[model samples]
Structures are given as C-alpha cells and as structure tokens.
Target: MRAAWAIYKRELVGTFCSPLAYAVMVSFLLFNGVVFYFFMDLVASNPSLSGTRGPLQLFFGSTILSVLTLMIFCPATTMRAFAEEWRSRTAETLLTAPVTDLQVVLAKFMGSMTLYAALWVPTLLYALVVRRYGAVDWGALSAAYAGVMLVGGAFVSIGLLASSLAASQVTAFVTSFGVIGGAMFALGLGRYVFTEESQLRFFSYVNLWEHMEHFAVGMMDSRQVVYYGSVVVLALSLTVRALAARREA
Candidate 1:
C-alpha cells in the first residue's frame, strides 16, 4: 500500500511538472466557456429553456460539452501512463520492484483520475453563476456532476488499458481515442444495422448515452451507477493483466 502511494504521488507530481497538463486545463476551460455562452444565448432566444427552474437544461448543455472535451483530452493525459515508462526503460525497474502489478496499475489509474478531477474544478463557476442569477435546482446539478465524474473515470480507465497495449506514446494516444470513439458511436451504428426490438434493446443497454440520459435528467438509477462501475473495473482488470503479461515477457 505504501509503495503504491509512493508511485501515485510520483505520477501525480510528474503530470503537473509538464506543460501538457496546463495546456489541457486551459483548453478545457476555454471550451466550457464558449459552449456555456452559446447555450445561454440560445436559451435567451427560446423561452422553453427557461421554463424549468431545474438545472437540467444547463446540466445537459455542460455535460455534452464536458464529455466531448474529455474525449479529446483524456487520451493525451493517459498516453504516457505506461507506454512512456516502457519506452524509456523505467518500466523494468518498476516491474522488478517490491510491488505487485495490480498495485502499479492502480497507482497509475488513480494518478490519472486525480488529474481529470482537478481539471473539472474550474467549471464549477458555471453552476455558481446560474445559481446566483438564474433559477437552478441544486439537487439535479449535483447529481449530474456526480454522473459526469463517474463516466469520466470509466473513460480514463479505458485509456489506461489502451496505454498498456501501446509500444509508443503516439500509439497509446491513437488507440485510446479509437476505443473511446468506437464506444461513443457504437449504439448509433448498432441501431442502423439491427432493426429488431431485442437487438436494439441490447445495443441501447450497452450505450453510454442511454445510461447517461437517466442521470442527466436528475434520476439516480442504481443500474446506471453499476454499469459505469462495471466498465471501470473491467478496464482496470485488463490493465493489470496486461502489465503482468508484459513483466513475464
């Protein structure tokens, strides 16, 4: 446990020491600001957006923007989680250390999740502003944020797994993006090909959109929470297995 924490601290500090983390933070904030402004303007023109005192409209707007930004940023953030260490031969030292492969993988996963959480802080200003000047439902807003974090964690786990499979940073980045992009678009493609009710229901069950919509509407569905948690566990398990196989090889 101590060894894992040491590795976790090392990776967390290393991430901030580079310009990449700063660039991702700045770019994410800028994208959020632009998207929020556009949504606010649209709401101004369409009174329907103002009907609900709840933050669902604003939450949905921000949620979509956040997911898109995360899709682009998370791959870059996780690209070097394992690939860079392997490239520089440092992975050999770590693999041979007095720590299990699962511990190492968990440390890297937590470090990346920490970075993603840090990036989400600045966006809280949007919620504050809406609360002060506009009608907002705090319960729904908080629930939506929770859902976003869980979904982001799941995506980061997937990225970490991709990083383990890659031989280079570029390969890791590309693979991560491909995996995330495929997952995001899979339901739509499945719908196009499978017209039957049973097949469509199965595809919908596998879709993030289907699950996220429930949370975005302020419903705390246990099934959705379990679905996201399952993804996180599956990805992390694969990552640990990959690391063990690499050590053997």
Candidate 2:
C-alpha cells in the first residue's frame, strides 16, 4: 500500500509538471464554455427551452462536453502509463520493486482519476454561474456530477488497459480511442436496432449513456451503479493481468 501511494504521488506530480496537462485543461474549459454558450443562445432564441433551466439541461450539456473532453484528453493522459515506462526501460525497475502488479496498475489508475477530477473543477464554476442567474436543481446536479465521475472512471480504466497493450504512446492513444469509440457507437446503435421486447436491454446496460440517463434525471439507480462498477473492475482486472504478463516476460 505504501509503495502504491509512492507511485501515485510520483504520477500525480509528474502529470502536473508537464505542459500536456495544462493544454488539456485549457482545451477542456474552452470547449465546454463554447458549447455552453451556444446552448444558452439557443435557449434564448427558444423561450420554451429557456424556461427549462434546471440541472437537467446543465447535466445533459455537460455530459456531451465531458465525453468530448475525455475522448480527446484521456488518451493523452494514459498514453504514458506503460508506454513511456517501457520506452525509458523503467518498467523493469517498477516490476522488480516490492510492489505487486495490481498495486502499480491501481496507483496509475488513481493518479489518472485525480487528474481528471482536477480538470472537472472549472466546470463547477460554470455550474455555479448558471445557478446564480437561472433556476438550478441541486440534487439533480449532484447526481449528474456523480454520474460524470463514474463514466470518467470507466474511460480511464479502458485507457489504462489500452496502455498496457500498446508498444508505443501513439499506439496506446489510438487504441484507447478505438475501444472507447466502438463501445459508444455500439451502445447508441443497440438502442435503435434492438427491439423493445428483446432481452438486448441487458446488453445495452453497459452503455455509459444508459447508466448516465438515470442520474441525469435525478434518479439513483442501483443497476446503473453496478454497471459502472463492473466496468471499472473488469478493466482494472485486465490491466493487472497485462502487467503481470509483462513482468513474467
């Protein structure tokens, strides 16, 4: 546990020291601001939507922005998780250390999640500003934030798994995006193609959008929680296994 914390601190400090983190933070805030402003403009032109100023709109708007933000930044953030260690010949050092493979992977995962949460702080300011001028549903907003964090965890896990498989940073980034993009597309297509009466609802349950909808509407669904939790476990478990294999090799 101590060793894991050491790795976590190292990763966190390393991430903050790099210009990449700053670039990602700026890009996220700018993209979110532009999207939110556009949404506000659209609402202004259509008064009916304007009156709907609760957390639901804010959440839905933020979810779209978060997806885009994660898609762009997660790869960059995770690309170095294993690929750089391999490139620098540091993997052997970490692998031969007293830490277990699980600890190493978990440390990296937690570090990435910490960075992601930091990136999300500025969005809270935007939410507060919206609340000052418009009606806000605090309960719904809280739930939505929880959902966003949950989805972010899942994405980070997927990215880490990709990083484990990749031989290079670029490969890790592309592979992470490919996996995430495919899952997202499959989830959307499943909703349209699957019959309402079919048992495919079980399969669609894996979709981040489906799980997130419950929280966006202020409902805390245990099923959705389990789904997201399963995703985290599955991805992390695979990551541990991948690292173990690398160590043995």
Candidate 3:
C-alpha cells in the first residue's frame, strides 16, 4: 500500500510537472469553451428547443462534438502512462522495485484518472454560467458529471492497458483511440441493427449514447454502473497481467 501510494504521488507530480500536460489541458479547455459558446447561443436563440432538458444536460452528452472530444482527448490523456516509462527506460527500474504488478498498475491508473478529473473541474464553471440564465437542476448536473467520470474511468483503463502493451506513447494513443472509438460506434449501431427484443435490450443496456442520455436527465441506471465498473476492472486486470508478462520476459 505504501509503495502504491508513493508511486501514485510520483506519477501525479511528474505528470503535472510536464509541459505536455499543460498543453493538453489548455487545448481541452479551449475546445470545450468553443462548444459551450455555440451551445449557449443555440439555446438562447431557441428556448423551446431546450424543452425539459437543462443547459448542462444538453451540453454534457447530447452532441456528437462532446462524444468526439472524449474519443480524442481521453486517449491523449493516458497515452504516456506506461508507454513513456518504458520508452525512457524508467519502467525497468520501476518494475524492479519492491512493488507488485497490481500495485503498479493501480497507481498509474489512479494518477491518470486524477488528471482526467482535473481537466473537467474548469468545465463546472459552465454550470455556474448556466445558473445565471435560469434554474439549474443540480441533481441532473451531478448525474451528468458522474456519467462523465464513469465513462472516463473506462476510457482511462483502456488507455492504460494500451500503454502497458506498447513500447511508445504514439502506439499507445493510436491503439486506445481505435479501440474506444470503434467500440462506441459499433455499440451505438447495435440499437438500430438488432431487431429482436432481447438483442435490442442488450445493446441498449451497453450503449454509451443511451447511458449518457439517461445520465443527462438524471436517470441513474444500475446496469450502467455495473457495465462501466466491469470495463474498468477487466481493463485493469489485463494491464496487470501484461506487466507481469513483460517482467517475466
């Protein structure tokens, strides 16, 4: 536990100290700001279109742009975790230390998730801005944020697994981007392609689009909680195994 905590702190500090982290943070904020501006303008011009949905609800996961942003940026956020360590020969030293593979994987994962969460803190101001215009649904906003974090945790775990398997950050990013993007697209299409009731039900249960829409409206489904938790656990387990295999090799 002490080793994991120490490694986690080291990873957090090292990541924050890097120029690339700041670069990504600024780029993410800039992109989200532009999207929020357009969203606000659209809502202001067509108030009726907003209907029952709050500004934050429509802003969180109702648009293709938001989905695309996550597809691109989540991979970017985690690409350097294990891949950078390996590329710089730091992984060798780290792996030789008095730490279990699970601890190492968990430490890196927590560090990456912390950074990912920090990226979203500034976006909360959007909620404050929305509050000035009208009544904000605090419950729905909280649910939307929870959905974002759950989705982010799954994406981070996938990216971490990719990083563990790759020797360089570029490979890690590309692999994770493809997996996350492809899964989102494929699962989304399942709702339309599957005709049977059971099949459609299954697809809808796993669909990220449906999950986000529900979360945006403050409908917290237990199935979604389970699905995202499963993904994180599965991905982290694979990462630990990958690390052990590399150590043995």
Best-fitting candidate, measured by TM-score? Answer: 3
Encode model 2's per-residue lDDT on 108-187: one tens digit a residue.
Answer: 99988888888877777766777676767778778877877877788889889999978998899999888887885356
Per-residue CA lDDT of model 3 for 99-211, tens digit only, reads: 99999999999999899998999999999999999888899889988988998899999999999999888999999999998885568669989899999998888788777
Instruction: Evaluate model 3: give its TM-score.
Output: 0.97
Listed in order, each prediction's TM-score against the native is 0.90, 0.91, 0.97
What lDDT is reached at residue 85 by model 1? 89
> Residue by residue across 1-249, what tens digits does model 1's lDDT show?
999999999999889998878988898778778887877667767777677533444545335554566677778778889998889999989988999988999999899988888887877787777767677776777677787787778888989998998999889988988888777546434865788999897776666654555555676677667877898999999999998787778
Report the Cα lDDT for candidate 1: 0.78
Ranking by lDDT: 3, 1, 2
Candidate 3 minimal-lDDT segment of 10 residues: 61-70
Candidate 3 wrongly placed segments (more than 4 Å)? none
lDDT of 1 at 71: 75
RMSD of each: 2.3, 2.2, 1.1
TM-score between model 2 and native? 0.91
